[model samples]
Target chain A: MSEPRFALGQRVRIAARDVAVHHRVPAYAQGHVGTVERICGLYGQPETYIHGDGQPFTRLYRISLAQTDLWPDYSGSSRDRLDIEIFEHWLEASS
Target chain B: MSDHHDHDHARTFQPDHTEPTSDAALLGLALRELLISDGHYTAQEELRMMDAMQKASPHNGALLAARAWTDPDFKHRLLNDGANAIKEMGFNLLPIEFTVHENTDSTHNVIVCTLCSCYPRGLLGMSPAWYKSKNYRARVVREPRTVLKEFGVQLGNDVEVRVHDSTAELRYMVLPQRPRGTEGWSAEQLAAVVTRDALIGTQRDLDINAVAD
Candidate 1:
């Protein structure tokens, strides 16, 4: 509902706290920090998807997280990274 | 290294090979009957919808990939706005969002649906069973290089393996790099070499032999 709280190339962290809301952020990505890769257009909240006409559209973003940051003992190329789309509500500003 | 659920998937589902006689099936039938009787849709409309869904195939993605390889402008558009670009190619994508990930020499892209197997079904047809398997959904985001190896795609550290975890609203398809030895091949020939796995990122190197004379 609020204008996209984050901007392109901005650094942000996914909300580590578990909330009682239907969200798209993955569990593994929670609390991890990443760069905003792309500023995708907004869409309805997942909870309101079934009958979402007239519901406010929330800004969605594609965040790129380094593989090294995701796992403590990742056994793959350090160059590897994971990108996942998350709603603005589940993200917080991070240094 | 771990699973979200403690139980085995095999303990619950074997519905694929069996006929539907479960409560879920009855509920589905009831819903269908209600919709039809309530004039929401006729049985013919339902059949037509199913027919349209079945019409999806990897051939659609192949055509897109080949066209992108040949036409720079089309490729730019495809990478910028996937849904519109695909519609320009004569494919009416569903209302959901679509994004095309380009696999370059330095960066390899793989797609997975961590929550559920969300894919660009409109462009590339139904997802492969393995794409929907829990193992792939779990491992692809964690140790993608190892998973790629299992799928016969060996990537080096020089290339960044970018794993995309598709969400409910957004879906992804990878536009693999054009294979070598096709100096002046036609779009048709290039499409012939594009496989479903290639479009999904599991199969990167296109077999040049597929288009050989």
Candidate 2:
């Protein structure tokens, strides 16, 4: 298992890999920038878990993305947000 | 044991979504038979597991929610480490990660499984069918305010709506803010007010009417 690369409160971007496979990140969340709200303990990667091999469990994080940043014409409160659990490989350090 | 059989509403989930049912059912039956035939699990074992899962109801989660309302320390532990907290309550948790979101004055929390119907079954029982519907899975993340309105829950712009999308790794159960009045009700009495809909966040306030006289 790989050690967690991201820390809580760190800004990270979800990779925009849109190719069709068993991916966990929803299409709407691709390429979105969000802050890591938590460092969930290591777990099996879903992309591989579907194909019968989920070895090398890696880090997962609960990311908080602003609701306004996600939708083009979001009309809700500015404080609205989306919390999603993301696996490590799909994330990269963001500014 | 609320089946939440409120499908009478026309627009919640498309009641006519019968396009792919047979295909999924065929696949499910095939998988079950294969598992039994291969001895990975017997038919009786499969039935027993189904019964166990079905036996789990929203009552378990209601107990915890009511407990949190009554016990400050337990509430803290539940919010901080949901997995251990539920286990401490004598409930068997699955290997999957468990987390709880608390509703507050400034923010209202709701849960959805955009990818699939991933729910905290051990704590809250089988998710209502609408939760697994294509309509809810797609709309809850997009227009939560409108969805809440459909459920008769109207929140002002002041309360930020926070939607938690279950990406399947971590399961979530929402802790609703306890309603005012019934100041000295027992924990069991308080549990009666926290509906599964409120626990899921589509509904916010507890239905005090549910408390037995």
Q: How accurate is chain B of model 2, given as a TM-score from 0 to 1?
A: 0.84
Least accurate stretch of 10 residues (summed lDDT) in model 2 chain B?
B6-15
> Each predicted model: what fraction of the native A–B Cα contacts (within 8 Å) does it retain?
0.82, 0.84
Chain B TM-scores, listed for every candidate in order, come to 0.88, 0.84
TM-score of every candidate:
0.89, 0.89
Model 2: chain A TM-score against the true structure? 0.92
TM-score for predicted model 2 compared with the true structure = 0.89
Q: List the residue pairs that clash in candidate 2.
A: none
Top-lDDT structure, candidate number: 2
> How large is the interface RMSD of candidate 2?
0.8
Tens-digit lDDT track for model 1 on B51-149? 777788999999999999999999999898888889987897757677899999898999999898888776677999999999999998888888999
What local distance difference test score does each model get? 0.84, 0.85
